[model samples]
Each structure stands twice: as C-alpha cells, then as structure tokens.
Target: MDGVNAATTDPLARIAELPGVDEAVAEARTVVDRLLGHRVLRRRSADVSLESALRGAHASAVLDGAEAPLEQVRSGEADDPRVKGALRVSGELGQLVETWPKAPRQALARLHTLAAADGAGADRLGRPRSAAEQAEDPAGLGAPPAPIEVEVRLEALGALLERRSSAPAPVVSAVVHGELMALRPFGWGDGVVARAAERLVLIERGLDPKSLAAPELGHLQRREEYTAGLRAYLTGTPEGVRTWVLHCCAAIADGARDSLATCEALKRG
Candidate 1:
C-alpha cells in the first residue's frame, strides 16, 4: 500500500546517528532483564485484570496531578486517590502490553477518546468546548486541535511504527513524542498522552512500561534542564529534537533499571 514513506532522515534515524545509542540500548537491556526477573517472581496466579486496573488508576493520577511527582505515585502517595488512579492506569497499560501485540493505534484511539470525554466535561477532569470552539482550535488537552490538519502527522507516526524492522522502541517513541508534542491535540492532556503513549509503545515491544524510568518524570525532576531540552527542540533545529530523543532514551534506560530494582526487592521480600 502506498503510505507515508518513513524517511531514513527522520528523527529516529538522526537519533541512531547520535554518539551512544548502542550503549543506551545495552543499558536498556539490563533494565529489561530486571523487569522480566521481577515478573518471574510474581505469583503465577497474579490477577492480570486487577493489576491493569491499578496501573490505569495510577496513570490517571499522574496525568491529572491527582498524584504529583510521578515517582511518588507508588510509594509516598499510595493512599492518595490520584495515586490509586495512576496505579489503575499503569496496571491497565501493563495488561494491554501483555495481551495486545498491535497496540499503538488502539492506544492512540483510547487517548483521543479520553481527551474527547474530558473536553466534553463528561469526565471529572474534562471541561466543555462548543462545537465551534472545538472546530477552530489548533492545540489543547481535551480535544483535537482546531481545523485538525495534523492528522497527517499521526499517520506518519503509524507508518514509522509499521516499517521499523528492529530496535522499535526508541524509534517509535521519538516519532510519537515529536508528533504529539507538535500536534498538542488536547488542551490539557497533551503531556499525559505523550507520556502514556510512550509507555504503551514500550509495553507492546515486550518491555515493561512501568520500568520506563519516565523521561517525562525525569524532565519534571530537572525542570529547568528538561524545559531547555524541550525548548531546543521546539525553537531550535532538528538537532533540538534529536537531543530530546537522546535524553528520553536515557531516561527510559534509567527508569527501567529503577523498576527492575524495585521489582527485585519485592520479589525477595
């Protein structure tokens, strides 16, 4: 089928040209090992459905600031309702990862549905937008940007995902992040969608999404530097985007390691 031809000159290719992708992948592998090891330690009968609910709830909390400091969602704020929401989201995401091989399209659709629901104020976090207001917008959190010319970008992303031969995670993530951030489809949920979308990709790749070590969280951690990285991408050249991808890759590698450690500890206990 004639589709958007993903150019080797795309940002994913540019990321490969960077100095340390091999090292990043190697590090990512260690994190993956820990994740698998942790999973092995879980009770064989562990309720997959229940886990999914927990993960989804946690994801919601993080996106909604029902839980602040994404890292605290599991520990410090365990009792917080937002944390519970984030947990449910995360768990749901994990199950989706395990069961669904082709999840990107589904994930995107789900995110859009969530944003639309919110925009219509049907959700606790959503606000209302009139048909005219929704039609004229360019970028927001609850609905697609007005005029919606950017659906092409999403098409390009799906094409990239389909054509990837190997090393799909970083490539998929770089393209998805670039497009979503650029599109900013929903008024308030852009960041959440971007982050959640990355998590979805990682899970589909047979990696642990929770182990993502969340570059966005890291970005939040180093707000000034992270914002500068984002600004460089948004205002500078493609180099800025390349730099952000590298940073994100590094964050994922780091988060995987942390999750592995936590999983291992839990297993031992």
Candidate 2:
C-alpha cells in the first residue's frame, strides 16, 4: 500500500539462479498436476463442500503432516476453539477464493471495522497520533501522523493489481504478506485475514488458490524448517525467503497434482 517505492524488488530471477530452484519448481509442477485431478473429482461430487474438499486435499498431500479428516471437521466435535476457528476461517477463505478480486485496501479496512465492532481479535486500523503529540515542541516532529496510511496502502495494492504485468507471483505474494503482517490492521483474526488476502490475490490473478495450497499448512507441516526459513528471511538474509517461496510454489503444484489424481480415480470408479 505504500507506493511503488514500497514495492520490493522481484527475486524470482535471482531465485531461479539459486541451486535446486529449477528442480524444486519441476517437482512442484508435478504435484500441482495431481492436486488438480483430485479437485476435479471433488467438483464432480455433489455432496462435497468446497471447504472440506480443499482442506482434505491440502492437508494430506500438500501439507507437511497428516490432515484432519473431513468428517472430523464437519462433525463440529473439536474441543479446542482454535481448531474450530481455523476450520471456520478456512471455509470463509475458500469462499473468498471463489470470488474475484475486490479492492484490497478497502476490503481490509472494512474487515478491520467489522472486527473492531465485534471484538473479533485485533484492531489494526486505529488512528495514529500526530507527531506534535509525540514531541514536547508541537511542530518539531513535523505533521501529525495521518490516520489514512492503511487506506493509502489499500489504494496502493489496488494500483499494484491494476498494473501488475511486470511483477511476478512471488513478488506480489511477498508484498501482500508483508503488508498484512506489518499492518495487523484488524481487531482480531489477523492471521486468517492475511491468508484470506493471499488467496484473494491468487484468485484475482486467475490462479486456482484452492489448488495452490495454504503455506501455513505447509509451515505447520515442517515446523522447524519453516520457522528457520522465516527467521532467515527476517534476519536480512534472502536465502530463507527464497526457500520459503519455492517451498510454497512446490506445495501448490503438489496439491494440484494430487487433486487431479483423485479426480481421475473417482472418475474411474
């Protein structure tokens, strides 16, 4: 949302030069093919809920660990509120994935407003105090901190989406993730909002997010590795960020491939 200035440099080409990136991409492509097939089968099934279908496909093959069964989620028997919340968020996210792109910033702002009203979780969109308030001398700190940075960021995101021909998927992804994480603009459910925003971006680009898979699920799967990668990325090293991005891309491809395979099997049956 900042501006083109806030837009980070695309690292795909640089990442491509890294060792094993190509191989990773190839493996990812294969996995995506299979996931796509499974999605087809689920689509063919009249009784399958879209949320359940994606959760199952993502959990088993694309995610790092064993997925919770679809029946278990639908049964609403989980004692843990977090698990229930996760499932509910996942379903809402799936629905958003099916919808086309909306104004990212405005949507986020509205979500924050709703979150604040309902005491959902976090209130990220609160106003910032003027610099005068920060300093003893009124004008020394310069103009007051505007309350509209969030709106500005949202507008910037919309602009980015409008003129995205030059940006690669990973770069777009990075920007989106960085903004949501940095802003934390909602009163609650920041994590879910961030993930939902990512899915929305993918869907807007005509990418099948349902097939692309959830990186959080993957992060959860390989917890140590995932945390290490995130730490590396955050520590001014690009290696971990590159690793995480490629891992996500690979998961997307793998999930799609698995979905495709399931669809084929269902068809044969």
In model 1, the number of clashes is 35
TM-score of each: 0.66, 0.59
Q: How do the residues 1-269 of candidate 2 rate in per-residue lDDT, one tens digit apiece?
A: 33333234423344444566557655654564455445444456332235434453334222212245555655755333334444444454444442324445555544334323332334233222232222111112122223366456656656665554444453455446544544444423444445446545654554554434444545445546544544444444457656655655554454444445445666676
Stretches off by above 4 angstroms in model 1 are: 1-11, 38-88, 94-106, 114-120, 123-146, 165-167, 209-216
| 16-102: candidate 1 lDDT, tens digit per residue | 555665566557657656555556336631433233334434544444454355455435556654354344345455545643335
How does each model score on lDDT?
0.51, 0.45
| TM-score between model 1 and native | 0.66
Q: What lDDT is reached at residue 14 by model 1?
A: 49
List all candidate RMSDs to the true structure.
6.2, 9.1
Candidate 2 lDDT trough over 10 residues, lowest sum:
135-144
lDDT of 2: 0.45
| CA lDDT, candidate 1, residue 91 | 40
